[model samples]
Target: MRVLLAGGGTAGHTSPLLATAAVLAEAGDDITCLGTPKGLEVTLIPEAGFPLELVPPVPLPRRPNADLVRLPANLRRTVKATLGVIDRVRPDVVVGFGGYVSVPAYLAARRRKLPIVVHEGNALPGVANKLGARLTTHVAVSFPDTDLRGATYTGLPIRRQIADLDRDALRDEGRRYFGLDADRPTILVTGGSQGARRINTTMAAASRDLAAAGVQVLHAAGRPEEVELDRRAGDPPYVVERYIDRIDLAYAAADLVVCRSGANTVTEVAAVGLPAVFVPLPIGNGEQALNAHPVVGAGGGLLVEDAAFTPAWVDSAVVPLVTSPERLAHMSRAASGIVRRDAAEQLAQLIHRAAQERR
Candidate 1:
């Protein structure tokens, strides 16, 4: 099979795109990607060893403005560029995860009458996927309640490492690797690849309290020097790092997690069976909060506002929870129950069905 997958900018879009691409590649499919030079896909797609076709990003501005006035011409130019790429790649099917570049790719694929698969990762569909879904019957979504036409609840496709993770089996090695005490309850704190300033600061502030309660913290602070732990002597329970390359290890070591509620994060955490205190990004379409809803509503996790996720809340709520092994175990079971582990395979089958239709 030959495929052209489109998505970029944020990790939320790119992660699922790559997850599906990996599955297709394993089945001997030739995969190509469409993205913009400015987007993260420039680095990520190539690193995954797939051919990436670059296109100019055409962003549809909100509200009436000069940019909105230029939308038609910009969209036309991008669609034309995308058409050229489509002609050369001649993919049997095009799969798109919502992003700025996806709009043109979807439009071009629609014009070519190619099978187009649209994956919306958020509980609320984005404009690009929403537009694309109007033209195709293959629409896959992460959350069950996503309002999209012809949508299938495929869940979020996480990386292979996350999908295959065995936290109980890897706990000792993961804790030892991170210099955390194996006997103590460990909490992993992260704000994603770029990091969340609010989450970082709050986690740092709560580290001392976390240590005092005989709990260990593995904090991924994100930036170069965002978190600096002050330890008097021996190994403090709180360990801080700028970023974590091996998040599987983090998941293995963590009994609980404190992080943002992006679709990828929520899905990954739940997949690993780690109960989480989700702090959704305050800005943007309120999708982050919605992304956490199903998991939290399922008794798998707890959702808190960014502003309310203070050190005091950590002392009051988090400390109590982690100390209670029975409660943590119950929540862990709930979290794991919410994951559809076959999501990557499910999406791969959808792509295969769509691609097969062209033949």
Candidate 2:
């Protein structure tokens, strides 16, 4: 089977797209990806060893303005480019992961009368995906309750490492790899690729208290220079890194995680059965809060608003949670079956079924 997948912009959309692509390729499907030049996909798709097709991105303006006036023309141009890609590739099916590029891909696939599969990664559906949902019967969402035209509760596709991880088995090696103490409780903090200023500062502010509680922190602060921790010679190691290339190790080392609730972040953390403190990004239509809600409701995690996740709250809530073995174990167990383990393989099967149906 030949599959053309459309997704890009950030890791939220790209990670799942790539994960599914990996499974499809291993099963002997020819995989091609569609993306906009402006998005991270310009490099990411090619780096993942897939053929990438570029189309102009149609960024819908929120307010009525010059961009809004130019929207139709821009969309038409992108749709034409996408159509050209589709004709040349001649895919059995077109799969869309919601992003600016997906709108054009969905429109083009329909114009060609091709089989289309749409995947929505957020709790709240995006406009591109909403439009795609109407065009096809196969619509899959990351969260269970995401309302769309024809929604199926296919869990978010995640990396192979996370899907196969056994935290208990790797804990000792992970601790040694990060140079963390064998006896101390470990917490991991991250705010995705670009990092979060609030999380970085607040975690730094509460570092002393956390250290005093005999806990270790693996803080992957997006911006290292901005988030400075006043470290003493013998404080429980508050190790900071700009980014973590190998997040599997980080998960193995952590009993708890404090991070943003992006779709990819939430799904990956939950899939690994890590207890979490999900601080949803204060902006953006409240989707992050919605993304973390199910886990929080299931007792797998706690959700905190950006404005309220202060150093004081960390001392009160986070410090105690890390020290309590019983609560951590409970949260870990709760987080364990929320995200399906074989989502990448499941999504691959769905894509193949869609392709075979078209025949």
Candidate 3:
């Protein structure tokens, strides 16, 4: 089977597509990725040894004036590019993970009469997924209560490297790799792959407080800020980086996590059974807040509003959890309950079924 996976813009959007593609590849499907040239997908897709077809960047305009100016041209380009790729690949199915790029890919799939699947990884449906859902043959979701109706709750598809880690070995390796004193509690702070400036500042200010309390920190400060953070927070008690390629190690070592509430991050935290304090990004139609509700509601994590986020709040909320083993254990159990490890398998099965039916 030939499958075309489409998504881009950020790691949050493309990671799940890569995860699903991995499963399909393992199942003997020839997988290709269609993505915007400058998006993370360009680097990530090629790094994974998958064939990546780059199209022009078609960023959705948020402002009225910009939308009026660019919409027609972007739409035309998107349609043309998508159609050209579809005709060339002749894929059996096109699976979209949700982003602006996914919109045209889905449309092209429909035009070709190929099976299309949309996987929404947010509690609220993204604009692209909302459009795709209407025409898609199957909708897979990360969160169970996502806005897209008629979607199966397949959880978020995480990369196999993280998914297949041996739990006990991961824990031991993580502790040693980060040079954490086995007796000290570890707290991981990340603002997604890009890093949140606010979160980074707050965590940096509170680093001393964390260290004074005998807590170790693994901070992913995004690309530009990683060096600054490393210079600011030196030594074994604080390990800082711009991006975490080995997230399994970070997740395994962390007793608690403070991060943004991107859908993929939330699900991955739950899958790894780590307690978290989620500070959703305060933008883009309040979607991140919606993503955090389920995890917060399940007692797996705390949802800290971006405006309410402060070093004190981080200290207050996280310090107690880290200090109390019982609380940490309960939160871990709650987090574990929120994810299904077979999410990718479930989504792949649905796609296969849909493709067969289409045939």
Candidate 4:
């Protein structure tokens, strides 16, 4: 099968796009990704070894009347550009992962009457997927309660390593790889690939407490310069790196995770059974909080608003939680079964089914 998959910008969109692409590639499908030049997609997509086609981005503006007035023309031009790519690729199916790029892909695919599969990675559908969902009966969602027309619950697609990780088996090796003590409690703190300013500051402020409690912190500070730790020469390891390319190993090394609740992070953490303190990004459609809800509701994780995740909260809530092995074990068990590990495969099958039925 030939497919055109669309999404871009942050890891939230690109990570799932790559996960689904991996599954499709395994099935011998010809996959062409649609993205704008601006985004992680420019590097991530090509590095993943898939052919990517660029279309002009047609961003949806929150500003009323001004940019909104020009939206129709902007959308039309991008849709035309997207159609040009679609025409050349001649895909049997078009799968959209909800971003500005997806809007153009959806519009073009709809214009050509092609089979369209829409995947909503957040608890709430984004603008592109919301419109795409209206054009197709085949819509998939990461969270169960995502309010869209005929959306199926097929949890977010995650990396294969994360899906197949044996955290218990890899614990010792992962610790040694990161130069952490084998028996010390570990917390993996990340704020996606670019890092969160608030998370960086708050965690940096609480570094002393975390280190003093005999806890090992693997901080994936996207901005490494922002993370200032005041640990003594012999305190429990407080390793800071800009970003962890080997996230699977990091998961193996962690007993708990403190990170943003972007759909991808929440889904991956839940899939790997890593108990988490999810600090939702304090922006956008409030979907980050909603994305963490099912796992949090299932007793798998704790959700704190971004503003509330301070050093004091870390001292009072997080330090105690990390130190408690029994609670961490229970939380890990609860987090494990919350998200499906075969989400990428599920989405791959759905895409193939849509193509077969329409073709």
Candidate 5:
């Protein structure tokens, strides 16, 4: 099968799109990605060894202005460019994950009368995906009860490492890899690729308390230099790094995680059955808050608002949770049941089915 995937703008959209593409490519299918030049996909897609076709990004302005006035013409040009890519590739199906690029790809696919599969990775469907879902019968969603037509709960197509993670089995090796104690409780703190300023600073301030509690911390501070902080010397339990490429290791080694509740983070954490303290991004349309709602409701995690997730809260709440074996075990069990392990494969099957309909 020849599949053309359209999604970008952020890792939230692109990560799942690439995960699905990886499964298809491994199964001997030809895959091409359609993304805007400005998105992370420009580098990530090519690095993943897939051909990426560029399209102009047309973001819908929130308020009426000059950009709003230019929306019609921009959409026309982007749609034309996307159509050109579709015609040249002659793909069997075009799959869209929600992003600015998806709008044009969805429009082009419909004009060509091609089979379309839309995946909404958030609990709240974006404008691009809401529009795309109307043109296709095949719709997949990460969270259940997403407000979209004909949506199937496919889960997020996470990276193969996360999907296949066995925390217990890899715990020792992961600990050794990170130079953490094999016996002590481990906590992983992260805030996506760019790192969260609030999370990094708060985690740093609370580091002494966490270390005093005999818990090891793996803090993937996204911007280590930007924040003026220092790791305590003398065999410190707090291991701080600018970034961690092998996040699988971090997950395996962690008994608890303190991080942002992006769709990918929530799904990946749930998939691995790791108990978490999810701090949803304070901005946006409250989608991050919605993303972590199910997990927190299921007792798999705790949701903390940005303002409340302070060093004081960490000392009062997080310290006790990490030290309590019984509570951690219960949260882990709750998280373990919420994920579908074969999301990537299932979505690939849907893409194949959509392609067959075109025949």
Candidate 6:
């Protein structure tokens, strides 16, 4: 079967699509990724050894005047590019993960009468996914409570390496790889893939406090600021990195995690059963907060508002958990309860069924 997957703009949107593509490709299906030239997909898709078809960057307008001026032109360009790609590829099915890039591809697929499936990876649907849902025959979701009508809770598709890790083996490997004392608890801090300035700064300020309390920190800062923070931190027990390629290793290594509440991050955290302190990005209609609510409500993690996130709060809230074995263990169990490691395989099965029905 030939499948066309489209999504981009950030790693949050693209990574899951890539994971799904990897599964489909391994199963002997032909896959081509369509995305904007400027998005993270340009770098990531090619590196994954797949064909990437570039479309023009279509900016979603924020203001009415700009929307009126640019909407027609942008739609026309998007339709042209999408139609051109579809004509050449002639994919049997089109699957969109969320982003502005997905909209045109979904529309184009509808025009061609191809089967369309959309994966909504957030608790609150984005404009693109909302539009795509109407055109799609199936809507798969990461969060169970997403308001997309007729959507199924398929969980988030994660990389096979992560999905397949044995919990006990992961814990053992994590301890050895990071050289943790095994007795002392570890805290994993990340600002998502691009890194969060607020999170980084807050962590930097709280690093010494963490060290003094005997907490080992593995921080993925996502940029120079994190590296600088690492340099400033100095010595063993505290590790800092600009980016982490082996996220499975990080997840396996961490006892407690502090991170953004992006859909993928939450799913990965749940998959690995690591407890978290989530500071959702305070932007774009409070979607991150919406994503965190389920985990927080389930007692898997604590949701700290961006406005309330501070070194003092981190010390007060996270320090006690890191220092106390009983609390940390309890939270870990709570986290494990939320993860669905077989999500990718399950989603793939659904897609396969959908494709077959379309044929």
Per-candidate RMSD, Å: 1.3, 1.0, 2.3, 1.0, 1.3, 2.1
Model 2 Cα lDDT, one tens digit per residue, 151-249: 888889998988899999999888898889987999999998889999999999999889889889998987997677877778998889999987999
Work out the TM-score per prediction. 0.97, 0.98, 0.94, 0.98, 0.97, 0.94
What lDDT is reached at residue 272 by model 2? 92
Candidate 3 residue pairs in clash (backbone atoms < 3 Å): none
Give lDDT tens digits, candidate 1, residues 1-359: 89999999988988899999999999999999999988889898899888999988888776789988889999999999999999999999999999889999999998999999999999989899999999899999998899999999999899999999999999999999999987998889999888888888777777778778888888887773666555554545787787798899999999999999999999999998999999999998999999999889888889999999898999999999988889889899988988687798899999999988789
- List the candidate 3 regions with Cα displacement exceeding 4 Å: 223-236
Clash pairs, model 4 backbone: none
Task: Give, for candidate 6, the lowest lDDT window spanning 10 residues.
Answer: 227-236
Of 2 and 6, which scores higher on lDDT? 2
lDDT at position 115, candidate 5: 94
Quote the positional error of residue 313 for candidate 2 in Å. Answer: 0.4
TM-score of model 2 vs. true structure? 0.98
Where model 4 places Cα greater than 4 Å from the true spot, the runs are none
Runs in model 5 deviating more than 4 A are 230-235
Q: Model-by-model lDDT, in order? A: 0.90, 0.92, 0.83, 0.92, 0.91, 0.84
| RMSD (Cα, Å) of model 5 | 1.3
lDDT of 2: 0.92
Candidate 4 local lDDT, residue 61: 91
lDDT of 1: 0.90
Candidate 5 displacement at residue 19 in angstroms:
1.1
Deviation in angstroms for 227 in model 4? 1.0
- Backbone clash count for every predicted candidate, in the order shown: 0, 0, 0, 0, 0, 0
